[model samples]
Target: MKINQYIRQAQYKKGFASIILIGVIVLVALGGYFTLKAKQKSSPEQTSTTATDQKVYTISDTNKSTTNQLIAESKIIESLKTNWQSIQALIPFRPGHPGTVAWLSPYSVQFIGKNNLLVGFEDGYNPGVAVLNFNNDQFKILETFKNQAVFTFSDWQSLINKYGNSSYPVSTYTVSLLRNKQIVSFQDLINVPENIFLKNY
Candidate 1:
């Protein structure tokens, strides 16, 4: 009789322990679910709610990355402004399309890589593009494009079609030009398509 009583108590204890184990597992799962929900609620939205959100995020969601890239590029251009004269002097050849050189100026200069620069030359009648490689204060012209047609854009639509809708290079002065023309919400100028150099002249 005593043996039977002890067996029943052992069985009860085992069932009770199993119930406690199940309860603990269920509690842990609920805690984890609530924690995940809390984190999601606290997180910021990936897309802006409206245009009034912020200046940086005012553009379309697809343009956020483009805007960021342009901002960073603007900073680089500003820093390189101090060395404009030295950079311009590195151009070995003058572009002459119709007649005399007239004027040679590097209007839009931006770094395409760590040591490579894509320079846009405004030579009066013949605007051109030049890719220069610089190292240790020395600049070597890799290639040049002296086609006036490539740099001409009638309006914003023509500009987009030419440059694949990417953000264009802009200067402090040109910012107002873009605004006055109402070309785009942001200031920009037609940048030379980088792929032009990939092909043979």
Candidate 2:
């Protein structure tokens, strides 16, 4: 009888221990699930938000990336201002078609379009080209010209002639590219049907 009682008590204790082990496992699982949910709730959304929210203010692999980007943009803007001022002052070349806006031309010597002053030479601006907003006046200059990149008006006109009306006697693409302190032939305004160079006007 004593042996049976001892056996019964041993079985009970084993059952109780098994129950406690299962309870501990279940509690740990539940706790882990809640912890994961809390972590997800604390995470920030990287996308699926408005542009203002999703816009990256700065991008850099190292520290001071924002500062470097701002400095780069500022330098480009200053170059643009200087070029605009030069065009107005006629530093090296005189305005080819002054007093009357040309709007387009194809001579290698460089000619201001009849529409330059008519539109104040503000053809249109892209990411590389910046239009100043200080005095509500539009201005343009090559942002990457100093890197030896070129934007030729003749090339632009050729494309326009090939893809566009192909008329020999028509308006010239009123565009210019600036690089390395001089006008470049990398990008200029051209009148393509798709407006590859001449867009945003």
The TM-score of candidate 1 is 0.35
Which tens-of-lDDT digit does each residue in 55-159 have in candidate 1?
Answer: 544566888865675555455555455465665555555556567543454455644444555566565666666656556655666766656323332432333
RMSD of each: 20.4, 21.7
* Tens digits of per-residue lDDT for model 2, 5-110: 9999999999999999999999999999999986555212111222212233554466354445344333433444445544433222233434533222211111
Candidate 1 regions exceeding 4 Å error are 1-67, 95-104, 107-117, 132-141, 147-201
The per-model lDDT (C-alpha) reads 0.50, 0.35
Measured with C-alpha atoms, the lDDT of residue 38 in candidate 1 is 69
How displaced is residue 195 in candidate 1, in Å? 11
Question: C-alpha displacement of 6 in model 1, angstroms?
Answer: 99
TM-score of each: 0.35, 0.25
Question: Please, what's the RMSD in Å of model 1?
Answer: 20.4
Best by TM-score: 1
